[model samples]
Target: MHVLPQVDSSPSLPRTKRVFFALNDYERRVFFPEYLAAELDALNGEAHWRTDELPSPAYWQTMMQELQPDVIVSCWSTPAVPFSLANAGSPLAYVCHLVGSVRNLVPRTFLERGGLLTNWGDIAGKTVAEHALLLALAALRNQPGWRPIINGPKAVPWRSGTMRLQPRSLYGRRVGIHGFGHVARALIRLLQPFDVEISAYSAGVPTGLMRSAGVTPFTSLLELATRSEVFFDCEALTPQSTASINATVLAALPDDAVFVNVGRGPVVDEPALVREAASGRIQVALDVVCKEPIDPASPLASLPGVILSPHIGGPTFDHFPHCGQRALENLARYLRGESPEALITPELYDRST
Candidate 1:
């Protein structure tokens, strides 16, 4: 346990809100630097931090009952906020998450009871879109083959004709995006310079909205896949979207079409995607997979026409401060009795990855 020095203890000031930091040691250092910690300390509150990465339930319960924090700053390693601490009668009112996906750290009942919650939100959208573009370009150029071609036993000639990987270009390509959320929108901006024709399909997103963004909106995923030379999966993970990209969708892509996914992996049928790539019918570049830190037996580990990354598609490590700052800003707003940005709604929560 650690506590920031109280900056104000005047009797006339409003009651000092108790702010708890439910982060492990590593998360604390990464998300809250000294300056950010000082900034948080500047708020009209007392900040108490948790040192344990995996505290016992009894320990957490005891701490919560003792501190009765009005706000909690949490991250990936933090445990789920207990039910007793999230009710209407509890003083705990807000949770400022330093990263995405509050579903693990927060209970749905917390929001259902009028408690506030905020995460990094769309701050990492541009980063994710940037990675999606990288994956597409890499897939078209056959990036995975370069290493083997250069280091293999066969001494291939330096001449361009000697190279066997038939690399392609992104110029004038027909690009189809499966989702029109933040990442997809940012990807559109990046694709403009490539002179690519863009089309998009999201379950309920209006075509008018896509048209306003200067992209054709398809009503069906199959139609989008049929027409696209490059297919991007950016759909969120939800009951409806899970396994939506099945064998039929994979079979729809034009031959040699590059497929990219920087979004949730379960959105696509993993086995179907694997079979498609294994057959050399389509090239794949994925930053996410259905089983993260992928199972060794997964075909993705050995497929030739596939490029896989360990889900490093967004807001790289250096960007932690930005998320921390956003959390601080949201906390400041809540303290000021002003509405916070990126408040997690029930709809957003229902669809979180």
Candidate 2:
């Protein structure tokens, strides 16, 4: 039999209270693969809340009042874990959000009451960084331009005597990343083998670390845009950052430069991006859009040199179990009275997407 190192064959997790499944079946299947779920089931306590849709907020309050579970495991579709549900019986001791960003689902009261909140910040960073890398490569190679050929009939020959879009290589290109968070750092490491010049712009990253990583730290967005062959915007969306990438910043890039956005849509000025790409001054690829599903009337849907995906820039179904295992590890640590990793503090939330 094959041995999987990640599965714990040791004693079941010692727990005093119930652990609620604050996610749907699809999410559970992804995060808690069969083996891992079985391992968890073997733990000291039973898993609760297996509903496809979580109970109504009022009913949730009543459920909490009754069961007072010690732990709540959450994911993308989870509703906010209300303060009333937390207690000595349940205490709302910890929440393990398998996905990132608790800004919407996690209520402020939970944080105030000192409940342990954690997200996929422990593992999702690398996966998201890889998505950004995929966009970078697709943009560099002009994947959008050639995509129409695939949509066209196979009646035409793929080989052409004259190529319409000259494929560009990633080797030795100057790459600029707007935010030096986990995704940017992971991207920088991935680009190392390609021998690309890396520079980053983010107030959050220390100058010393950038220098140590062989990444040039550009203090201003304009400078990073002006100097790179390819640029990545991974900035978080905050009121202060909302229109940070305006027309002037986009125009600062050298002509024909590739720009990728795997970050928040609002961080880039939507109208300005549409105008820029329409003018053919710069190339752009996006996994996130200003409006979801891309409005049929939006010019971005037809613009040349623009590639878009429906915001699936992170780990897909197959890799979800890895993220799940990471969450289970955190759950085990909390049951053992240790500080679960990736605890979200106010400062951390402010910096996250």
Candidate 3:
């Protein structure tokens, strides 16, 4: 009789399952909340110190060679993994991300090698949607321009007989969204209570989809822009969409309209946006800019109609542990030989790449 190796399939997990946390202390503080950290501590793992500034490939390779971690957990602050780590000799089997977009950090080769990658997914979208709403309301009220006139050294001193257009409220306004996506959909759901007329333009997506989501669908982006009192750009940032919103698109927005962009900055022509907002015809609220940590001298910084937040629309504090919990759930499934939810498919890889 031939003897075969027995597979250990038990409800009790392997205590020796190795995990590598690829983030420094600062990253841990920012991304890995205390609740999640405690959960991670229960899993057998070694914490590796690494920052984006010094993404030493050698350090990663050395750690992998020494510890031979079975899984890795990382965030935006973590550096890209070395391609060589996808080799058959490599012990790496899976990666869990707290961040949303993985195209930059996750190499296509890793996916090709049958590696599993999971992320926060819908958790990220919902939180970003919340920030988008905050910005829209702030833009509608022209809150950015208020601070100066109220009290600072730049106070306007309450002029005599100089009148202007009153800021519009989100209620009863026509809201148009360009690129109906997860974030846009969330925005619509949140907007349901406000009783705003909603219209959306999604390229390639069927018009009926948006209609079913309780929003009117427009054929072209220009038509959506022309009809909207407030316009949102929630399009994915891809090669096909870089700077898709140009001066012409900005021109299409109605006079005294509010333009809010929590999406990627490259989609909009920064110069054109500055010019339009400078004219006082458009109130621009942006969470992302063409260039991040915008220069102090940048014209957009001085514009009263423009409000800017430092790309903080996602990965909120309360959300850190939520992503970790989702990742842990998927990790459990992966160990059980079941399909891990949120695994990046070839189709998803194509859309992002």
**Number of the top candidate by TM-score?**
1
- For candidate 2, which ten residues in a row score worst on lDDT? 1-10
**What are the TM-scores, per candidate, against the unseen true structure?**
0.94, 0.88, 0.84
The list of candidate 1 runs beyond 4 A from truth reads: 1-14, 152-156, 161-163
lDDT of 3 by residue, 204-299 (tens): 889889989989999887888899998988888877678878888889999988898988888888899999999998888899998888888999
Worst 10 residues of 1 by lDDT: 154-163
Query: Under the 3 Å rule for N, CA and C atoms, how many clashes does model 3 have?
Result: 0
Cα lDDT, all candidates: 0.87, 0.78, 0.76
Report each candidate's C-alpha RMSD, comma-separated, in the order given: 2.2, 5.1, 6.1
The alpha-carbon deviation from the true structure for residue 288 of candidate 1, after best TM-score superposition, in angstroms, is 1.2
Task: List the candidate numbers ranked by lDDT, top first.
Answer: 1, 2, 3
Candidate 3 global Cα RMSD: 6.1
Please tell me which model should have the higher TM-score, number 1 or number 3.
1
Candidate 3 local accuracy as lDDT?
A: 0.76
